[model samples]
Target: MLCVEFFAILFLAYVILSLSFERFLVSRVKELYKSLIPTTSYINSINQAEDIDILTSNLQKLNSEKNLEIELLKKEQDYRREFIGNLAHELKTPLFTVQGYVLTLQDGVKDKKVVKKYLKQTSKGVDRLIYIIKDLDLITKFESGIASLDRKSFDIVEVVRNVFELLEMRASKDKIVLKFDKEYSKQLMVFADKDRIQQVLTNLIINSLKYGTERGVTEVSIEILKENKILIRIADNGEGIDEQHLPRLFERFYRVDKTRSRNQGGSGLGLAIVKHIIEAHDEKIFVESKVRIGSEFSFSLTLNQD
Candidate 1:
């Protein structure tokens, strides 16, 4: 009887110990599994990642962004080089002309007529230099956001009429008729910087006159656009630009024909300045042209409600 009791007690003790060990082993296994996997609320630092696919995806994205940044830097460097080169070229022409004329006078030219002629030419060169400098300053101000606009309500129709009158002599010289598409009797008031808007109008109309065919018609038109906007367009029956030229046409000093005449005498920054002015007003400018057909430059403005 004593031997049987002892054997039973030993069996019970063995079973209890086995069950405790199995429960402890299961708890240890659960902790190991948790360490191997990530929880939904887990976050990893930049240098640390638990999942291989997530690491690969993050690396690919970083590489793409780096490549994009490098490409942009390359483009910007090229553009800077081009802009500097163009500026030098534009300034050199007038500078050389003025220097040549001044040297000729310094050589003691005898005839008053010859001296007067050279002086006049020298004066023209100086004027051109001034024009270029002013345009450059204006555009720089615009690009740097240093320019200020005196925004107010003004009659746009009167402004166009005034621009036409101001350029009347130049237009008549080439027999280019500068007129409105239709007569506007009532005032078409707009909210903008009056002087700056005038400058925009003048530049656009001047471009039409300069590039238009002799005796071609240059017309200004204004139409009411939706959302309290007004559209102004300057159209000319001129030698239309090629399709490719229109894209970079507003770029400063960009020319369709590099060999085109400079005798037309412009600062070459007109379109660029016009673009800046319009954009400064939070507006967009557009151009359309067809070879051998014509070109139209247009922009929109906020119509003055009051």
Candidate 2:
């Protein structure tokens, strides 16, 4: 009986030790959990904040890019609308004129004077239409690289003299004087497509005459800009182009004067064509003008080296 009692006491002591150890272990676990929780939460919060900032930045950048694209598309749309409207207006004017003259002739108005007058008027309208179409075609060819340059060496002074002589009657009619800055008796040889250069000069001189003040002077001058390039200038003491019109001077079909007299005006493609021809030669062109003071159109050309 004593042995049984000792065994029972040893069993009780073992149970108490096991219970105490379990309580101590549970307390240690709870403390460790409390210590690690704030650090884990803080790290998680930092990671989340960084992720949100990046997402917001990316979203804002995307929105800005989208807005820019939308603005560009709107501009293009507006430009296209304006272009179409101008084109239709330009073509319709001469067409209507021609049609009216034809209908008048067809109505059997039989006087020879009337008939001749209508015929001439109709002919002028047709010529204007033709000029517009031809100029448009030439610009297309230039833009497409289909118009090849025929470079030849020629005396620029002789070319200018020819232009002066050709327009002598026209200039005299307006009482306008056409002259070179000085007598270029010596050869001013340039390498370019002679015909195209002549055309450029004709367009510029004619433009000056058309818009020039009555009895104004249109002058051509040359300067040796560098060893390889010469500057050719066509300047006029006439009503000058406005500042706003200067930026788009070379745009096709652009007109400075909305009510400019068509009788004395051109196809409105002269300056655009001039720009294309000059650019094709890998050259530069510039315009300087002021209201009333005058206008000067200058371009550089390569000197003939051979």
Candidate 3:
């Protein structure tokens, strides 16, 4: 009996020792898991901080770009205002001269021929002043998006013919031959503001006439492409625009020959008006010229398919 009791006691002691060891091992595993959780949380927080920093950097870059754009816009606005002020000042001189001449004549400068000469010059100056003011007004309206187009469908040929007829007197006086090459069909129609389109054509034709060689020919041509657009080209045989000036030809108050242009009564705003008018119709205008050879001003307008 004592031997059996001793064996039972040994078995009980072994079980108790095993249970204590298992409890200690479980406690150690829990402590290890608890410690790892804080490390994982710390790593996640660091990654979040890095991401936030990167986002802040991107935002700052975007802000810098925006600020730069704002500054550019402001500068452009200032330049435009200054340009207009200068143009106004420039225009005022001739206007005041004409006014002074008229006043002098009114104050009894009696030679009829002398008076007539002054009157003619004054009249020319007045006309030039009127032209500049009109062009400036039109540009302002266009830039402000306040210019309304009178959209209509018209035969492109008819418009061309009309413009040709209107400028015939001037062309004849200049001894310049004006011709039209009818490459397109007679019934080609275009969708655009008729008056504005006519204005563009007039400006182009007059520009050609102004710069065309003495007694040289100026040609107007119409070409219809399969791309559903109509091209009108005004070409002149004259001293063509320089490569450097070509890009800025459509800018307001740009002059290739300032003195000659002024003497010829050019306000340097005609081409600019033409450009804006063409663009306002969602069309495009371009120019190509070779020095001493000639220049061709071409513009494309949407065609009426029907």
Better of 1 and 2 by TM-score: 1
Two-way lDDT contest, 2 vs 3, winner? 2
Query: What TM-score against the true fold does each predicted structure earn?
Result: 0.82, 0.78, 0.77
Model 3 gets an lDDT of 0.83
**TM-score sort, best first:** 1, 2, 3
Better of 1 and 3 by lDDT: 1
TM-score, candidate 3, is: 0.77
Off by over 4 Å in 3: 1-52, 55-59, 182-185
Give the distance in Å from residue 260's predicted Cα in candidate 1 to where it truly belongs.
1.9
Better of 2 and 3 by TM-score: 2
**Residue-wise C-alpha lDDT for candidate 2, range 110-210, written one tens digit per residue:** 79999999999899889888988898888989989999999999999999889999999999888889999997778988999999999999989988888
Worst 10 residues of 1 by lDDT: 40-49
Candidates in order: C-alpha RMSD to true structure: 9.6, 14.1, 13.6
Tens-digit lDDT string for candidate 3 (56-112): 564478579989999999999998897877698659868887898889888987799
Selected candidate, larger lDDT, 1 vs 2: 1
Q: On a 0 to 100 scale, what is the lDDT of residue 11 in model 3?
A: 96
Clashing pairs in 1: none
